[model samples]
Structures are given as C-alpha cells and as structure tokens.
Target: MVEANVIYVLVAREFKKFVRDKSRLISTLVRPLIWLFLVGGGMSRLVTPELGMSYMKFIFPGILGMTILFSSIFSSLSIIWDKEFGMMKEILVAPVSRFSVVIGKALSGTLISVIQTVIILMLFPFLGIKMGLLSICYAVAIAVLLSFCISSLGIIIATFYDSFESFSVIMNFIIMPMFFLSGAMYPVNKLPHVLQVITRINPLTYGVDALKHVLLGDSGIVDFPIVTDISVLAVSSLLFVAAAGFLFERKK
Candidate 1:
C-alpha cells in the first residue's frame, strides 16, 4: 500500500479511538478551560497590568500551548499500546517503509492536537479575547507546526519504550518541566541564565512564542522572531521524524 494510505489508516484508527473515549474527549476539551479559569482566575489578581492585558488574556496563548503539549504527546501512547498487543510488530514488518509508519503516528497525534487547539480557540470570544480571522488562521497554522513537531518528538520518545507503564513514568518526569520552561506561564527573559538557555532549546518555547506573536501581536512578550519559531519547529519536525523512522527500523 501507499504511504499516504498508511498515514490515513493510522490516523483514522487513532481518530476512532479518540472518539470512542468520551472521557478523554471531554477532558481534552475541558483541560484548557480549567487552567484558564481555575489557574488564570487566581493568578490574574497577582499579575500586573504591565503585561498589556489581564492575566487570563496574557496566558491564552499559553493555554493553547498547553493544549497542544499534552494532546500531541499523549497521542503517541498508542504506539506502546500497539507494541504490547502485537499490532506494531505487524506494522513494522509490512512492506511500507518505517518512515511511513512514523509519519502515520506523527500525523495521528498532529490531527488530535490540532482539533483540541481549535476547540480552545473557540473559547477566545467568550474570554473577551478578540482576534480577527487572520489571527485565528495564523494561530492554527502555528499550532499545526507545533503539533507536528511535538508529535514527532513524542514518537521519538515512544520508540524507546515498549510498555505504557514505563512510558507514563518517563512522561511525568519530562512533561511538566517542558511546559514550565517553555515560557508558557512567564517571560523567558525573567528567568535565570540557566533557564533562559533551556527555554531556548525547547521546541514548545518557540511554539508558544510564535503563538504570542500571532495572538498577542504587540504585547511585547515575544522572545524569538516568528521566523525563528517556525524554522526551529519545521526543521525539528523533519529531524525528529527521521530519527523516529531510524529507531523503528532498528527495532526490526
């Protein structure tokens, strides 16, 4: 079969799994809402107006980043599931290239993350976060790039573990630090020199910075140039996919 068909099959299978899990679907739709309200509500008073907006508004882009972060990364858990249940073995031994398998998994995560991001975007109006159509379009564009980049990263990580239990343990150690360091909740410049270097290296930091550029506009909170964010994510996605493909091929 064609690689396109492989990607389609994998994407559809994941989509079906996603849809059938009502709890996950609800949680995915609700997680950002909780953060925006529960966390953003309390933090707003403590936050300063020098941010050029309310704290909730200031963190809207970050909330979007959070949505993509969790959704894209966890979607790769399907690989561990497939591996344990014997499905992944058949897939790896198939005539298709391992790159096709990796692309299939990456696209599955990307699709789910993008859907969750759009759901979060729909809340912008309700939150008094007025954005034009082009801004929304731009935000979605970056979400796609970020989602693919993150999903590729997740795939690379998933290749290392064959069990869901082990993967979950490792994810806990990595995910929170990645979010906190990504400049999602605070400015990177305010961080110490060590943290500043770490955030610069995080793909999500560039992604959130890109979201700030497109969403916050002249909020003056952006770190890197928009081109830098896109370049890093784009290049990283390719390299990560290549790495995941190589890893998957080696497992054969």
Candidate 2:
C-alpha cells in the first residue's frame, strides 16, 4: 500500500509538471504533424499505387511511432532537469523504494506519450486513414505498451547522464536509427536482406508493425504477425522496466 501510494504521488507530480509546460506540449504536437502532413505529402507523389496504399496511409503507423518515440524518450529529460535543480535528490532521499520511483517515472512517460499519440490519432480522418472502434482500441493498447517500453528504456539511459546536453546527444544518436530502421516508413520485407535483419532486431520495428496491423487492418503492408509483435513488446517492456529499476537503485 505504501509503495502504491508512493507511485501515485510521483506520477501525479510528473503529470502536473507536464501540464504546466505549454511550450513543451505544443512542440511535441508540431513535429509529428509536420511529418504527417509535409513529409508524408511529398513522399506520396513518388510512392507508386503498386504499394496498394497511399504514402500518407502507409506512414501513419510510423508517424505514430515517431510521436511515441520522441515523447517517451524526451520525457526522461525531466529527470535531468530535476537532477540539475536538486528535485531528484529530494525524491531519491525519500522513503519510497527505487522500484517505485522507476515504475512511477515510466508510467508517467507512458501516459504523456499516449496523450501525444492520441492527438495524432485524432488527425487520422484528415489524413485519409479510416479506423474503426476496434482499431482505435488496439492502437491505444499498442501505444501504451510501446510507450512503457520506450519510456523505461529512456529512464535507463537517463541514469547514465547528469547533463541535458549529453543526454540530448545520446538520444539523437539512438532515436534516428531506431526510427528509420523500425520499418515505419517502408515495407520491411522489401528492404535488402541486411536491412530486413536489422529491422527485425529493432524493437521499434515490431511496435510499428503492430500499429500498422491494428490501424490499417488487412490493407497494411507489413505482414508481420500481430501476436509476435505484441509478445515482443510485452517482453521488452518488462526487461526495460527491470533495467531502469536496477540502474536507479545504483545511482549515486
């Protein structure tokens, strides 16, 4: 009961901080919107009808992944900010278990990512992607799972960097490769053998593929099994949360 209360307090604190930051909220929406409209629009011209879906529709899952990826990972920046301002130390010295701290942070990041992704999801009608109730529910579930995995991964990464600058550099290096290689923008099967292997190994690829399956249904390009994708994401989320907890406990 005490641990649960600790988790709730920490999560509530994070949400309050997120809500107070208007600029951060807007910036989070803008990047995914730009990619969905501007970049997806331009690419739609060159992409052939042979692909069976418009580029906009094709990249929808990828854009969702991008939204979740950026939101989840950047959420960790709060840790660096808190540390710089000594807020983290105050929390660290509190009576809560390190596992509670990690879980609370991960859940908070997941909630933020899901909120951002839902905003993107609302633009689907404008983007020409048709989704039903079941699809929307599945997408939300997948987003929640993926957000947890990515957020936990972010927290683990955050434990290593006390400075925002260094954290930003590492995030940039990690985010792009993960996003591009996730087969979010293109069909994974069509990629070269080596690239296909790389995408297969990337956890984000499964998340994107799962989203594609749920959102686009039978029209989705990626034929990756939904069951497999969900299993991998669930396992990955557990692993990442455990890793973050372990790291947080050892932090100075």
Candidate 3:
C-alpha cells in the first residue's frame, strides 16, 4: 500500500477507537472546564495581575494548553494496552514502516486534541474573551504545535512502559511536574531559581507561552518573552516526533 493510504488506515482505526469511547470524548472537554472553573475561579482573586494580563485572559491559553497536553499524553497510554493485548504486534507485522505507526498514532491523538480545543473554544466567547480572524488562526496553529509536542512526548514515554499501572505512575510523576513548572497556572518568574531553570527546560512552557501570545493578543503578557519560547517548542516538536519514530521503529 502507498504511504498515504497506510497513514489513512492507521488514523481511521485510531479515530474509530476514539469515537467508541464516549467517556474519553466527554472527559476531554470536562477536564479543562474543571480546571478553568475550579482552579481558575478559586485562585483568580489571589492573582495580582503582575504578568501584564488579566486573570481570565492570562489563563485562557494555559487551560487550552493543559487540555491538549493531557489529552495527548493519555492518548499515548493506549499503546501500552495494545502491547498487552497483542494489538501492537499485529500492527507491527503490517507492511507499513514502524515510523508510520508512531506518526499515525501521534497525528490521530493530535486530531482528537484539536477537536477538544474547538469544544473548549466555544466557552471563550461566553467568558468575554475575544479574538479576530488572524488571532484565531494563530491560536489554531499553536494548538496543533502543542498537540504534536505532547503526543510525541507520550509516544516516547510509552516505549519504556510495559504495563498500564506503571505508565500511569510515570505519567503522574512527569505530567504533574510539567504542568506546574510549565507556567500553566502561574508565571515562571514567580518560581524560585531552581524552579526557574526547570520551567525553562520544560517544553510545555514554550507551548503555553506561544498559545498565550496568539490567543490573548500581542499586548498581553509583555513580561515573558515569546519568540524564543515559540522557537524552542517548534524545534522540540520536530525532535520529539523524530525520536519517537526512531524508538518505536526499533521496537519493531
């Protein structure tokens, strides 16, 4: 089969799996809403607006990034289950290259993440967050980048786990730290020196910053630089996807 056909088959299979799980679809939107209402609302009064942004606008992109990040990472967990059930072996035995398999999974996860992003986007207007056509386009681009990055991260981590329980523990340890350190809920400058270094290293921080810059208008969040943040994330996504392809191919 042609490479494009292989990609289509892989994506279609994954999409079917995604659609069959009603809870997955429901929770994808619900998780972000919880964070927006429970966490954002609870802490809104505490924030002093030091980041040159309003509380609602500042958190808007962060929550969006958070939704994409979790959705992608959790989506990757399916690989472990596939491995245990011998579904991964079946796919590996196919004529398509292993790299195609990894790319297919990542792209499918990204597509689902994008759908969740759209669902969450409807709430923005309700919250009084406004965006022009150009801004909306940029926001979609940022979402695509974030989904690719996090989905690639998930695939890389999946290569090391043999069981779902182990994967969950590993994800909890890594994902929570990344979420907090990535300036998802607060500014990096507010972090201590040690944490500042970690935040700088976390790829999610760049993604969040890029999303914030696109969604909240150029005038917002003037304190933290955005150009370099975007650069790092763009580079990281390519590198991560490359690495995931390599690792997964080796497994085959």
Candidate 4:
C-alpha cells in the first residue's frame, strides 16, 4: 500500500509537469507533422505502388514510433532536471522504495508517450490509413507497450547523465540511429544482409514492425509476426525497468 501510494504521487507529479508545459506539447506534435506532411509527401512521389502502398501511408507507423521515441526519451530528461535542481535528492531520501520511484517514472513517461502517439493516431483519417476498431485497439496496445519499453530505456539512460547537453547528445546519437535502423521508412527485408541483422537487433524495429502489422493488415511490407514483436517489447521493457531500478538504488 505504501509503495502504491508512492508510485501514485510520483506519477501524478510527472503528469502535472507535462500538462503545464504547453510549448513542449506543441513541439512534440509539430515535429511528427513535418515528417508526415513534408518528408512523407516528398518521398511518396518516388515510391512506386509496387512497394505495396503509398509512402505516406507506409510511413505512418514509423512516425508514430518516432513520436513515442522522442517523447519518452525527452520526458526522462525530467530526471536529470530533478537531480540538478535538488528535487531528486529529496525524492531519493524519502521513505519510499527506489523500485517504486523507478516504476513511477517509467509509467509517467509511458503515459506521456502514449498520449502523443494517440494524437498521431488521430491523423490516420487524414492519411487514408484504414484501420478497423479492433486494429486501432491493437495499435494502441502496442503503442503502450512500446512506450513502456522506450520510457524504461530513457530512465536507464538518465541514470548515467547529469546535464541536458550531455544527455541530448547521447539521446540524438542513439535515437536517430535507432529510428533509421527500425525499418520505419522502408522494409527491413529490402535492406542489405548486414543492415537486416542490425535492424533485427534494434528493439524499436520490432515496435515499428508491430505497428505496421496492425495498421496495414496482412500487407507484405511487415515480415515479422505480431507476437514476436510484442514479446520482444515486453521482455525489453522488463529488462530496462530492472536496469533502471538497479541504477537508481545504487545512486548516492
């Protein structure tokens, strides 16, 4: 009960911070929009129908992944800010278990990422991506799981960095490569043998593939099984959360 209360308080605090940041909310939405309208639009011209669908529709899932990826990682920056402002020490010295704090932060980040992805989901009608009710629900489920995995990863990354500048550098270096290797903008199988191996190893690849499977139906573009994607995400989320908790517990 005590742990639950601790988690609840911490999660609520994170949500309050998110709500009060109007500029952050707008920027999050704007970034994905630019990718969808400008980048996707330009690429659509060169992408042939033989690719199975329009480039805009094909990249929708990837944009969703991008939304979660950026939001989850940036949301975790709050941890560093807290540490710098001395708020983290206060929380760390509290009576609550470190595990609860980790869980709270992960949940808070997941919630924020999921919310951002849902806003992108709302753009499906505009993009002509037709998903049934069941498919939409499945996409949301996958988004929540992916958000959790990414959020936990952010926490793990945050544990090692104290400054936004340093963290941003690491985040960009890691996040950009993860997005490109994720098969979000292209089919994984079409890549070279070495790139295929790399994409398979990237956790975000599974999330994007899973999203494509749900949103695109049995389209030949996504070669991975949905179960495999979900299983990978579930295992990754657990591992990241465990790592974050271990690091948080050891922090002075």
Q: Can you list the residue pairs that collide in candidate 1?
A: none
Worst 10 residues of 4 by lDDT: 163-172
**Residue 139 of model 2, lDDT score:** 95
TM-score of each: 0.95, 0.94, 0.92, 0.95
Candidate ranking (lDDT, best to worst): 4, 1, 2, 3
RMSD of each: 1.5, 1.6, 2.1, 1.5
lDDT of 4 at 184: 85
Shift of residue 163 alpha carbon in model 2, Å: 0.9
Model 1 TM-score (2 dp):
0.95
The reply for model 4, stretches above 4 Å from the true place, is none
Q: What would the per-residue lDDT of candidate 2 be over residues 1-252, giving only the tens digit for each residue?
A: 128887788788878978998998999999988998899989999994867878888898999999999899888657887888899989988878989888888889999999999989888887677888888998999999999999999898888888777865775678888898897888888878987788887789999999998877767486578999999999999998898888888844
Candidate 1 residue-wise lDDT at 200: 86
> How far in Å is the alpha carbon of 6 misplaced in model 3?
2.0
Off by over 4 Å in 3: 48-54, 219-225
lDDT of 3 by residue, 39-141 (tens): 7887777784665545665787789888888888878768888888899889888888877788888888888888888788667776667878778777888
lDDT for each of the candidates?
0.88, 0.86, 0.80, 0.88
Model 1's alpha-carbon lDDT is: 0.88
Point out the higher-scoring one by TM-score: 3 or 4.
Answer: 4
lDDT of 1 by residue, 1-252 (tens): 238988889899999988898999998878889998899989999985767688898888899999999999989767887889999889877788778888999999999999989988888887677789998999999999999999998888888888877865766677888999998888889899998999988999999999989877866889889998899999988998889888877844
Instruction: Give lDDT for model 4.
Output: 0.88
- Candidates by TM-score, descending order: 4, 1, 2, 3
